[model samples]
Target: MSRIGKRPVDLPSGVSATVSGQMVEVKGPKGTRSFTATDDVTLAMEDNAITVTPRGKSKKALQQWGMSRTMVANLVQGVTEGFKKELEITGVGYRAQMQGNTLKLALGYSHDVDFQVPSGVTVTCPKQTEIVIEGSDQQLVGQVAANIREWRAPEPYKGKGIKYKGEFIFRKEGKKK
Candidate 1:
């Protein structure tokens, strides 16, 4: 038995969880988020909460049980409190700007990199160096941050590039003369 799967997810007031087709939708005061669970996992709405159960006792089913439950738990928390990720540009010429729902990143590249912000996600830049990604879906917020960081990952030589705030990069030593 999975310890995580055995735990029941309690639904707070004004929050509702439902299974629609293969997807599980979690609605809360903050927002709504959904995810398509694995085929072997079964989702059931009980009282004011939801339950995840495996179809069989096999290893595969057991493996998915905890994962599916954890994903559902994250969705519930996301819809309730939302999620955010911060990014920082660490270079002399690198910067970021928000034009409406689009993010313009100039990371020492010849051309500017433009990324369209998805619906239900908000990107805010207090300063050109600081960026914050917010969304009700934890997964979506994380994916967006990763995609943005991929545009110009931190370079080892100068340790200059786009990276998440508080991200650590080991600096490489230059060759001896």
Candidate 2:
């Protein structure tokens, strides 16, 4: 038995969820999100809560049970509170700024990197060294932050580059003179 799958996802006030066949849709003040579970799991809505149960005792069904439950939970949270990711740029000449819907980054490269913001996501640069990504979809927010950080990942020596705000970079000693 899956502990997480057994627990029903409670809908907060002002949030509503509906399940039709293998698809579940959640609506809240922020936005609406939908998730489609595999046939191995069944989705049911009752008493302001949604539950996921395996269709059979097969391995695939059991695997989808817990995953479907978590996916439903994420849908609720996404429509209610949304998701956010923060990135910090560290270097002598590295910086980030928002130009309209585009994010301009200077990571000591020959040419500045221009990142076009995708729909349903908002990119903001509060400070030259800070980048904030916000969206109703958690996966999109994380992916956008990762794409920006990929340009200049924090290096082991001196730790100069872009990284998550609270990320830690292991330092390496320099060669002896």
Candidate 3:
């Protein structure tokens, strides 16, 4: 048995978790989110918490049991406090601006890159080069941030590009003749 799988995900007041078929729905004061359990993983809600159990002792069951447990936990957290991701634009001419629900980024490119903010997520530019993305769903927030950063990932030489705040970009030394 997986230690993490055996543990219960405590639900705070006003939070409710429901398991239906392979889908787990977590509703709270903030919002509601749902996730589907993987194969061979059984989810049960009790004591205002969630317990994940595997059907058998097979390797696949064990692997999915832990994964499904964590996924449910994340969904619960998402409804409660949510998640956030911050990105920093580093370059001479790099910057970002929020136009309504769209984000415009200038990453030293000839043309600017425009990205639309998905529902349930908010993008804010505190500074010209700082971008903050916030949402309840961690996976969606992360994926959206990644898509924005992918436009111009930080380069190794000058470390000038789009990167996550506090992210370390190892610089490669030039050839010393």
**Candidate 1 per-residue lDDT over residues 13-132, each given as its tens digit:** 888877886698888887777889888888888877788899999999999999999988898888788899999889998889999989999887789999999988999999999899
Q: Per-residue alpha-carbon lDDT of model 2 for 1-177, expressed as tens digits?
A: 999999999999999888899999899998999999999998998889998999999999998999999989988998888899999999998998989999999889899999999999999999999999998898899999899989999999999999998999999998998
Candidate 3: tens digits of C-alpha lDDT, residues 69-170: 899889888998889999999999889999999899988878988999999999999999999999999989999999999999999999998899899999
Q: What TM-score does structure 2 among the candidates reach?
A: 0.98
* Candidate 1 to truth, TM: 0.89
Ranking by TM-score: 2, 3, 1
**Model 2, total clashes:** 0
Q: Which ten contiguous residues of candidate 1 have the minimum total lDDT?
A: 13-22
Q: Candidate 1, residue 128: CA error in Å?
A: 1.0
Q: Which stretches of candidate 2 lie over 4 Å from their true place?
A: none
Q: Pick the candidate with the highest TM-score.
A: 2
Q: Clashing residue pairs, candidate 3?
A: none
Instruction: Provide the global lDDT of candidate 1 against the true structure.
Output: 0.88
lDDT of each: 0.88, 0.92, 0.90
The per-candidate count of clashes, in order, stands at 0, 0, 0
Q: Candidate 1: how many backbone clashes?
A: 0
